[model samples]
Target: MYQSDITQFLNQLKQQKPTLEAEQRRGRSLLWDKQPVDLDERAKQQASRVEQTPYVYYQNF
Candidate 1:
């Protein structure tokens, strides 16, 4: 079988630290994992947003 340098390094790393994968999963969940979004809440927020004027710096007299 053929393995790239990165693959070999990863395999050796996993062997050295058996819990590395579990730790990675836990870290990923902390940052990347999220709960399901509430469509109703999102729609309400979108509907309540005010539209911005084309000329923000100029004051309308």
Candidate 2:
């Protein structure tokens, strides 16, 4: 009985915790092992879209 209870708890946890269920790749799962986006490439892409000058870059912490 106790073992069954533990198994039920673990099953509940598996349903709740993201890192477990995220392995299936069904929906937009959280990026567990994701690479950092290239800031330079992103900036170049944005710069190509907009034709403006004197832009101020502010760092938000």
Candidate 3:
């Protein structure tokens, strides 16, 4: 049996821990591991909007 360059690379890769999945987890934790900020509960009160569309629609002949 003979190992090609790619095979050797893969064999070395097989020994590694904190692999791609672990690295992703660590990165996410580093960036996103924090208490979530609370959102404002107050509703945006606005004055009643005037109608912009035609109040009466007639079919075109």
Report residue 56 deviation for candidate 2 (angstroms).
28
Over the stretch 1-61, how does candidate 2's per-residue lDDT look in tens digits? 3568889998898879858665567344454646789999999898889554555464332
How do the residues 1-61 of candidate 3 rate in per-residue lDDT, one tens digit apiece? Answer: 9999999987777677438678888999999898764444222222344455564465342
Residue range with the least summed lDDT across 10 consecutive positions in model 2:
52-61
Q: How many clashes does the backbone of model 3 have?
A: 0
Mind sharing the TM-score for model 3? 0.28
- Cα lDDT, model 3, residue 22: 80
List TM-score per model, in order.
Answer: 0.65, 0.32, 0.28
lDDT of 3: 0.67
- Cα distance off (Å), candidate 1, residue 39: 1.0
Candidate 1 C-alpha lDDT tens digits along 1-61: 9999999999999999999999999999999999999999999999999998888888574
How accurate locally is residue 40 in candidate 3, as Cα lDDT from 0 to 100? 43
Better of 2 and 3 by lDDT: 2
Which prediction has the highest TM-score against the true structure? 1
